[model samples]
Target chain A: MESFNLFASLASAIVLEAAPFLLLGSFVGALFEVLVPDSFIERMIPKTVPGQLGFGLFAGMVLPTCECGVVPVVRKLLARGVPPATAITYLFAAPVINPVVLLSTYFAFQSDLTMVFWRCVLVGIPALVLGGVLGKGTAADILNLPKPVLRQMDDIRNENHGHDHGHECGCAACGETHDESSRIRAVLVHTGIEFLSMSKFLIFGACAAALFKTFTPSSVLDLMQGNNFISVGSMMLFAVLSSVCSEADAFVAAGFSMLPKAAMLSFVAIGPMVDLKLIPMFLSTFKRRVALALIVVPVVTIFYLCVLLAYLEGGV
Target chain B: MIMDRLHTILEGLTTALLGAFMYAFSISDSYWMLLSPKFQPLTATAGFLLFVTGAAMTTRKPPRNVRRWGALCAMLAFLALACWAVLGPESAFAPDPPKKHTPMSLELPEPGEGFEPRLTLNDKEYVRISTPELFALIEGTNKEYPREIAMRGMVARSPDLDKRGMIAVFRVNVFCCLADAVAPGFLVSVDDPDKYPQGSWVRVAGEVVESAESHANGEISLPGMLMSFVSLNHEIRGHDVRIIDPPDMPFTFEVRDKEPFAY
Candidate 1:
């Protein structure tokens, strides 16, 4: 009975929390597959250092998925020959530094566009730069997954046999091979499959959050308030442990005004990239080593910048 | 062919679901807040347009011209919602005003000493209030006022009473529907054990106390409740608070526009 109640609550929270974003994320992913030129993007990665960073950041802004929702999409983007650095930057920054998230963060902080702008710039810059520096034309096969899943996905894409997908001319270029009816069916099945896979993790995160709010003692937060290195470290740790989705993180950050801006920024920057919840998805989707390196370098760099800013501002 | 049909059905369903989500989010209902702020009035409008456009483009049965119209309308709707959220007067899209706390004087309910009135009334208790009630009476009073106040709300974060005779309190203030709903703090606890049990929506007639005590959550608490009278209805199961205008609106706007309220 107790287990049933937990399951019920978890289900309620997941449906409530994940439904909208999951729908939006999957829809956007499908749209990208349809509308975006995969081969064109593959050819666009500049060999220069700054160019790679810029492309990575740009990709992050254009892609609309949240941290939780971006995994599979990032994997697909990588598989299509987008540079590892670009893929990694997009993987980390897409959910955290996107236009929607940036605007929402500004609104949450009551139109502090400077904070919004700096956050994106600060996080996006380093993520792109570090990812570029690390990837540096690494071998591609190391990142590739088993052949079967790719083949199956390709088959589904080719079949394109669902809904009004039989009609060909109106949709994206991929519509040529498969009729409109098949394409619609393929997208639908793809979406449902993606939802089933990620919704459980989303449900777990929501339930954990709800439980934390209900049971955790408020006195515990006092340890996090301050401008010192300890405070920054604690906040980052809290961010990782909480595993909050990027969309909802600002509010949590706002609830604590004592934490320095740099630390707060780092928390937001690092949480989506390195948290335990997202790590599994990262490993499965990208090369585990590449994923780990991408996350670690950004987190460390962002943390140092946070401390530096706090020191300069005389916050601690 | 069968797979194609199933896929089409799924696409149609996806479009409908997205449209329904946007529609539901656009209306700020009373019970809950939508989790994503991106699902604002503008987003909903855009999503609707996108749904229509996506619907038009993907479906073979639709007329040829429908896709263009759908795309055009979707783009237009997206722009409109974006504008409204960014520039609309009702939006918290602008910078927040500086915080000012000039506690409005609120009328305090008579501090009944020896024996308190039963807060969870077994029967309906008739209480009276002045026709011209001062907002001051309720503003900062920590205790429940004896006034017959009619504040409709949904049970928010009403946690079960701990062994220490305290319960975590929370409520959802609705400017619209579940979407755009904001969770405001209205922490209530009783001096006497189990006096005001958790999840009970009562017209608390008391003074909002100024003294601070450490909360169960370990944060040094600033405000607390000192209830003089409480009237709760057992029939009000899952009593969700739906306040149109909460007494404190400063932070509410930000909360509403942030997660759990955004569509």
Candidate 2:
């Protein structure tokens, strides 16, 4: 194929395949804008430091949004007086800890629960570590969002007239027409906005992944094979480059079956936590230093941890 | 006030265009070139949802745009991609030049240790099996004698197979999407090369032969059939490589939901 055709084919493939999941994510992200009142999460959060970290680690089981959807939720959490650290913990935890993502990881590994377990452990450990560490500071310390972006966060929070939806019944049977429709509209508007906002990074990321996939040859991937430590870093680096969603990245990792299990684990683990596309999203929500910390903390933790696992592979 | 509404409208318009582009591409004939047909339903449904969401944005009140310039740039970027997707030539999705170097990957597909074969000796009249299913069968089939399986695939004249007058019959197997599609095929020994042209769709029925060579060793090496405990591939040892019309279903689905082929 001509370079352009190959480029188009791969780019379009990545974009189209991911569009549905991205849309679903945007819808949910948008819904969080209106339906879940700002005060709701703040109230639910346990006051204790450990409680907050624990909540972030396991919240995905209750709410199964992938990495793509978690950003918006985290942003919303920050806006609603949810501690930046706790919200950051949720941000890290939501992608891998989530049920849908876990299930996808399981199926992609040919129904093996082992891969799923490792994926959770790898992701859980980081979010657990980061949630408490990163979660320590105030919104300004934790979130270095540009002034305008921070203002937008406020705008999203102020949507309910700075009012709590607590008085609103949680049940659908209430048949509250006025509240429901407005709620629905708010969700849609948010969905539209979020999709438009995030898709810029998504399209660019997908295109880059395709171009890399198309132009780079097999020998390039196999370079780090047999060497578990480098393989882990290499695959993790690839994960950052591809920026594939956690729900679907297993298939991509599985593509390089030759990569050590440790490497594949790192690929899936570090991907949801940080990536090129996600960096911008993180910047939009976090302080520059804080965002840099989010990336550095996990990348270092996961890489070394994965390298350790790679060394221990035969011992166990 | 007017500027806010206009920004909202432009946002709506950009989103609507994105939704429309998705919907349009999903239905276009060239869609298969971009994504596997199995994903059509999901892609189209998403497009519909996006469209509805975009339409709703027109009436729905938007949070004030704190960053108007950024929003405008996003709108333009979204519009440009959507426009390109809609108007791009069909060749954009397929190869304009012959795909000379589209090696499936550096690594061979994972061995089918736990996978069930697509066909068995008990099953009569071999019909069609996807490349992945066929490879799995070769690796997992426990039958003592080769199963008489009939299958169809496009001819890939690979030098790696290294057998004269034999061609690798393969199908594009989509594990997740087109981006992850791998060309997995088995070798078919044919009597004539003219009848079985390269890239021609053919149906061949034969006694399955397992290769002694281990398969999926990163590099695909098919010496013949890698029968149950099958390392990687299986071979169709028959002279009956007949020309056949391409099957309607363009790509194979996940193994669990695979059947219901439009043969």
Candidate 3:
């Protein structure tokens, strides 16, 4: 009974913290779908790969989202014909590079700008690399969307080509017409659908994270505190398991002052990019290969970078 | 077409139910048991958004090719979450007793001038501090040290502490949420620890002195080593101790500013 209480408390915390962001993200995604035209996106975004990656890197300033909320928005952007690299880059970088997260990190570390600088670099590099690598193919090759979503995207494409402002699209998902009141209604409907669709993944992720936190003992991590490599690996593992939010994760990492700086850095760096909650979301949102790369590439890159940092600091 | 409408309605109902649950939880006092007070506004806003969106969705025409299984699964998940939120413990987490004692390596600050404390009661010299502040004073490099201190927290007793004739009074420090809560406390060496009982709330006030022997030596146990560096080095020799009702907000938040407490 006690264990169950602990688990439930932890699960609710994650759910409560993530749910608001998810709702906001879903609403933003709906707006993107109904209001933001594909032509506008194409005109606004840069054409070259480097330019697109750079746009992706700083897109968080415009649309700051946490990991929980970024998935749905990325899905909407991809469907709206945003470049794969830009969407993917924004997916990873937005969680860390955003003002909210950076400010939180700064306060958490007592105004330590170096930690903030390194955190951005750590997430920024991987986001750009993944944006260039996994973002090569077309949306059809990279996205594993459901049949209804596919049809909706097709309807949107057809509507865009015909330049028709009429509500002739038969599908409810394609309710993006030029009518103001109808557009408002469509946005609300889309928001509702998107929120409900993504919530199951959020709940599942929260359960996994809560269970891990409740049952696991602190002693398990005590054994790894002696060695720098093991400490970094363990902290990274804890980041993935804890599934903490990017905005708040810096405080948690700073609390572990006993651990090496590299390990602490790894905790914040790897948490937003990949974790228990994100795995299912990634797999469900993207193709198998794309999802696998999104998960694997960051973990590998951050681990080695942290290890190198440890070596440089003479902690290893 | 009927099945499609039914699915759409189900989706709306489920979405509304979730929104209602979030809103209800955020407004209730029990939310403090799970998350920090800082998140209340955001939660309330999200809940309101979801409720409005779900209500609007129900009046619209049904979407084409609605995924029935997906909708049903979502409904079930939301229902489960609501149940969990309602049924879970409303109180803060009960601190577990330490299994083993291990000495902590903390640099003790020298007693010096310019020591300013947050709270003092009845014009007495005894300083009142939160658990997190006490932790900061110990772990921090602040030169100032108070002569006498008072703190309130849940009481925890175990064989290891019993052997040393002490009891731990701790308040769970929530950094982000309950998921990342850590119990940083002070060990009070009292004559009868059994009088307090485990998990009971109490206030302990005494002279601040370093433990002659590292009595309560154990690794600070919490999620992800939030304060793993802190061990039981400083203990209170209680001059006045008594059982007390739990505070309106039992948990302490991370102290980020110059002020001692985040509350």
| Residue runs of model 1 more than 4 Å from their true location after superposition | A1-26, A63-85, A141-179, A182-203, A226-264, A276-278, A281-291, A307-316, B1-263
- Work out the TM-score per prediction: 0.52, 0.72, 0.74
Candidate 1 lDDT over B62-170, as tens digits, reads 2212122232333233333323332232222102222332222122224253322233333433232210121213333333443322232212233343344333333
| Chain B structural similarity (TM-score) per candidate | 0.34, 0.63, 0.75
Q: If the candidates were sorted by their DockQ against the true structure, best first, what order would they fall in? A: 3, 2, 1
Off-target runs (Cα >4 Å) in candidate 3 are A47-49, A63-119, A130-181, A224-296, A307-316, B68-124, B141-143, B215-230, B254-263
Alpha carbon lDDT of each predicted model = 0.45, 0.62, 0.69
Candidate 2 lDDT over A97-187, as tens digits, reads 8665776676556577888888888888878777777777766566666445776755664454333333321211111112324667756
lDDT per residue (tens digit) for residues B1-263 in model 3: 88777876877777887788878887775666667667778788888888888887777666556464654584576467546655544342744323232221112112242334434455655666776677777766464656577777777677777777777777777665666576777788788877888778888877778878664335323222233233356878887788876765566655533333332
Candidate DockQ values, in order, are 0.05, 0.27, 0.31
Q: Against the true structure, candidate 1 has what lDDT?
A: 0.45
Relative to the unseen true structure, what is the C-alpha lDDT of residue B120 in candidate 2, on a scale of 0 to 100? 36
Question: Per-residue lDDT for A1-316 in model 1, tens only?
Answer: 3232322332232234334444445555455454555565667788775676677777756655667656655565655556667766666777766665675566445466666766776677667665666557543543556545664664575455332332211121122232344555546433433333333444344445434433334444344444457667876777777676665555445434434676667666677677776777667655677667666776777778777777885432
Instruction: Give the docking tier of candidate 3.
Output: acceptable
Q: Across residues A165-268, which tens digit of lDDT does each residue of candidate 3 receive? A: 23222222232222335778777887787667656655555666566556655565455566778989988998887766675566556655556778889999
Better of 1 and 3 by TM-score: 3
